[model samples]
Target: MSISFRVSNSSKFQVSEFILMGFPGIHRWQHWLSLPFALLYLLAIGANILILITICQDSTLQKPMYHFLGILSVVDMGLATTIMPRILAIFWFDAKVITLPECFAQIYAIHCFLGMESGIFLCMAFDRYVAICHPLRYPSVVTSALILKAILLMVLRNGLFVIPVPVLAAQRNYCSKNEIEHCLCSNLGVTSLACDDRRPNSICQLVLAWLGMGSDLSLIILSYTLILCSVFRLNSAEAATKALSTCSSHLILILFFYTVVVVVSVTHLAETQTTLIPVLLNVLHNIIPPALNPMVYALRTKELRAGFRKVLRLGLKNK
Candidate 1:
């Protein structure tokens, strides 16, 4: 990677771009390591696109739940796209240099999409909650207008909340080395390189993360708890089984999503000496969930499975 030197205001040289070391200790094997990451990234993009297409073309999927699923696919694609390409470049071609603007954009985008995903998960949980817990009110409670409002809220909320993170990072003085330790331009990774104290950035990020994804996760737990209570209260065993089955796929998706998130958060907070594990886990957290979401839904949800089959048959017949 070539470095273009620029002068900072303090007669010190500012770093115009940053070098992203793919993995700290495993740089020699990056070419070999890129294979699985590449596959997972492609799977994430392809699967989410497939889901989006199926959801858009199928009229029967116009319900609130499907609306949120479509939004989730979009968010998943955004999250995967935000960091995976640069990671692939760093791994495959030694294209590790990222400009200041590019770094900031990645930080903003990754955080925005993450916040949106958490919000989408919460919305889906609420959808299931209303569907099972308040069957009679489900139609009125969850509507197209409501879904639209929720989408708008998510976009505005996350977009506004994350704008500061990149802005704060951009304002700092970068008189030192410009090499970021991680594969992507994470907020902490980028900001930590600044010459100034990074505590404000860290504290702001910690607070916003809790206010955003943390709160979403907490509400999701509550929603599911209510759902379980409603399911158990059903007088008939078959009805309870049906209700639980409806949420099983969603529960699995949520479990893996939050598990990876929690693990990654803990690792970051712990500030362990071994950074590779957390970095790799973060990459998997972004890529694996998007790839797995469509499969989980298709295999577990009857309607989505039928929708996928119909869409596939239509495409093949057209071909």
Candidate 2:
């Protein structure tokens, strides 16, 4: 199969070992462009980490809902660390070369974190559902034991299901093509390098993608439906509006995430589309939402806004 190139290299265009077209091949302007991304990555990590700390230390945040929020922060940090450090390395140094094993490792992280994030969203949805639907029982329903079980289940579900895809992709024999046309080592770019039939791996990705994302989406939808039905029963329009406003934020975030998720899913199934398109889509999926996460919650939640004020005051006094 032939491919296109943006680089000026001639002989090595098709048969290159693996030219990772990360940073969109902007060799010169990349250094400058990457500065903003680097700052954003740092900001995302720091914001999430701080939020996690505040959630843990603050007595008001001791509830299971906040437990999920803290967990979400940790996972956000994990996911960002998994990819962005390598991304930074790529920008600072010229070490875009990822060995076969390293490539597999990256894919494993991408899969695992993707699954975990989905699980966290599922947990958050369930949390919202309980709080809205059965406000009286929200505390008891999301008990410590049950939360433990839910986390365990999410871990097992994600780990067991997505592991095989990378393993399968790793086992495939790459004839000569090794160029990953993206910033990070992804399942598709790796699978595309294989010389032999990759239909199985492709199918595995589709299935897992459907199961992981689709399942999360279905659960979220179900929860929201229940929530919508229950919320309308409340007598206070102000209360209903407040609750709807919160749901609206999550809905917007889910919509943003699904835009990339569905687009990439369709791109994979299309088989004729440019891999670059998906690579960019995947990058947006992995980065933009995360960068906005803290901002979203902060702008919406009164406590976080207050916490930010307190923290800023403390920092100023310290200075």
Candidate 3:
């Protein structure tokens, strides 16, 4: 079940092992480079987890917006867990081999989380839309039951969309280069090795691009446009300024998140002799967004600023 289907019977595509090209040119300062990545990975997880805890424990943050923010933290953790461990392993250990099952699992986790994150972000945009554009009805519009249902649907959609990808991909023959050019089992990385015509896989990817990311980005854009229009129509300058500040956090988040997604999603055609550029971009695409999100939200949101202060005070008290 876990075997790579190679064309030739003599040499099965090495299922139990995969070759990883770790951070190129890191042999000289591998140890030094690892420290920063280690720190960043730790910070990324810590900050995101902290945000999750604050959102959950604080009664004031139990609203639909923070509820979704907490969910984003969970998704960020999922994304970070899927990538950072493999990335850290490459730096820590000399061995960069992954078993066939493990490799496919990584692919699944990566795609599923990314897809799910998109849906969640779209939900968040709509959440902001209701909160801002229709403030009077925001509570009724984004009820706890409705938020849960939206979250479940998003999770279910991403899960269903990406679930078959790795499975179908793993079933194909991989007699070609077993050495993956990236740190992890990237979707295109695995599919590139398959001897079978990857039209179906390509189609699936296109469907996801249009349906998952495309749809989400569109809705987010529309929400923001409406939000901006509403803000401008306000008579008070202070009110308009305050609205933009809130919108800016989401806009910044969207910029970082979607740029990488768009980059990697389209870079499939850019593969040539060396996958160095594409693979590096792919890893960056995953890591940078999750890493940037907490910082952006914390810096941009006054409420989040207050929460950080409160969290710090509580921590000091506990200490």
Candidate 4:
């Protein structure tokens, strides 16, 4: 069967580009909102970069957990870069016009990075599980080679699975309205603009999301469940406290990441009543998680905090 339906004579002009109608109902004065967003982008980028550099330079952080943390930092930066620049352009400069290729590229990057992040979270959960449940074997099990393999699998899985999303979106005939009422070129936001059959595109997206995120979330929960059970079995309260502390940072980051994703996923159901909420949350979801991930780690993880302090002290001594 043909991918796109034939355009009827009554159809409007074909859409070669889309206008991202960022944050509907917000007044022009709200363009000032760009200030906070830009600041957030800077903070997220700076924090993640610092984390990456520290992980690379600090030989003591050569373990699987810190390796995975470095991967997460990179993924966070990619996610932020994918969505933030375009959003800032819309908010600060009113450059909302996105060509078809550019929109598809953005959609692809968003989906790919999101999947990668979810996978990395799962890897981190496993790292925590091993550290708590089998500390002795962790050195043998979660080696640098294993971490490299996991990262490669994540990249391949998401990169291969998410390709169809933009391909299917590109196939649709967008002969109607070209205005996207969102900050970023998301799969649903862009697919909804197509004047032709969108059922395949929607189904493809839903399946991919569930398959990628659903499996990752399920495994992460199982890992944590086992970790908790193992923690409870410990006779010493101090031991238990130390064990749980290792996971606290990861749990917080996971909660924030998945909560925003779940809320954003279901926002379409109440889109009419909560017009700006969905769009606003969608933009914030991409930016906030990346910004908060490093902060949570720095504040909660002792080793990371110490590493950052060490880096700072060395720089000061150099000066």
For every candidate in turn, the CA RMSD to the true structure comes to 1.5, 5.3, 3.1, 3.9
Off by over 4 Å in 3: 1-15, 24-32
Model 4: CA > 4 A from native: 1-13, 272-274
Candidate 3 per-residue lDDT over residues 1-319, each given as its tens digit: 1334333465655344677766544544554656766777787798898888777666667778788888888888888888888878887785677877898889888888988888888988898888788989987889989988998898888888887778777767776567675678876777777777866777777776688788889988998999989988999999888777767887888888888776765675765544456666777777777777888888887787788778789989999
In model 2, the number of clashes is: 0
Estimated TM-score for each candidate: 0.96, 0.88, 0.90, 0.94
Error of 2 at 120 (Å): 0.9
Model 1 global lDDT (CA atoms, 0 to 1):
0.87
lDDT for each residue of candidate 2 in 86-162, tens digit (9 for 90 to 100):
77777778567766677787788878877888888888888889888888997789899988999899888888888
Residue by residue across 196-234, what tens digits does model 1's lDDT show? 888889888989989998999999999999999888888
Off by over 4 Å in 2: 1-19, 23-28, 271-275, 315-319
| By TM-score: ranked, best first | 1, 4, 3, 2
lDDT score for residue 170 of model 4: 87
Tell how far residue 132 is off in model 4, in angstroms. 1.4
Question: Worst lDDT window (10 residues) for model 2?
Answer: 6-15
